[model samples]
Target: MTLVLFNKPFGVLSQFTDRGSPTTRATLSDHIDLPGVYPAGRLDRDSEGLLLLTDDGRLQAQIADPRFKLAKTYLVQVEGVPDDAALARLRAGVTLNDGPTRPAEVERIADPALWPRDPPIRVRAHIPDCWLSLTIREGRNRQVRRMTAAVGHPTLRLVRWRIGDWTLADLPPGQHRIIG
Candidate 1:
């Protein structure tokens, strides 16, 4: 079984191919050349970090299926410093338009030493921003972004640092390493 860990860069599609898109975007094919391996889960095009791909279908199912409840951790940079109440809401669970999200492990964290994003997040001279380490078991469509926005602190940047036991570590963006 071939298990590959890819550090997906911002603006790169989770899929291997880019077909019928309105604008040109980078796809997984640009980073991963290993044939037959498919992505186990998806990372949004606008988000960056660890994406696991494998040739084994059972392993892929284990990783992606919500029933397995693999914890996904994200390093989120938000527009403003979130107060205790806002953090409490995230910990308890927030109601989104789709539905109420499962309770998440959320905490304020120091800015992680990460690689610089290509375009960079928008900055305001007066407004204060902060970093948060959030872990959620379920992967919904832009769940992290929505959760932060719901609490009044819009996510400025999102990075998936770990999925289950797998982590990005020092892997630079757009690079893939075969672990097993």
Candidate 2:
């Protein structure tokens, strides 16, 4: 079975099917040459970073299933500097509409060297910004964004950095590489 590590670019859908859109453009199918492989997990169409695809159902399940405790890390840029208390709240688990999420590993990180998004994030003159490295074991719908919003610092930009043992590393946006 073929296994791939893809650095999904912004504005690209996670699935091969476009669902009948007028602008039928890029997708995982456009970049990944491997056949019979599907995304192990999904990154939002607006977010960019490490995505795993595999033909092996067992491997895909191992990575995507919350029971495996695979960690997914994201570098999030928020509208304001998050205080220690807010960080603590993130680490202690915040209640979302779904329920309280498992406590995440949250810490401030240096701004990574990143390619500019196709449509850049809006910048406000007065509001300060900060970046955080957040690691969560569970895959929840828009969990990171919801967590930040719950803490009063709305996320302006979000980029996934790592999933399990894989990372963004040297892969640029719209790039992909096959790995064990």
The candidate maximizing lDDT is 1
Query: Which lDDT values do the candidates have, in the order given?
Result: 0.95, 0.90
- Per-residue CA lDDT of model 2 for 52-165, tens digit only, reads 999999999999998998999999999899999999999999999999989999998778678888899999999989999999999888889999999999998889989988
Candidate 1's residue-wise lDDT over 64-103, tens digit each? 9989999999999999999999999999999999999999
Task: Give the local distance difference test score of model 2.
Answer: 0.90
Clashes of 2: 0
Task: Tell me the alpha-carbon RMSD of every candidate.
Answer: 0.8, 1.2
> What TM-score, to 2 decimals, does candidate 2 have?
0.96
Residue pairs with backbone overlap in model 1: none
User: At residue 31, what lDDT does model 2 achieve?
Assistant: 81
lDDT of 1 at 13: 96
Clashing pairs in 2: none
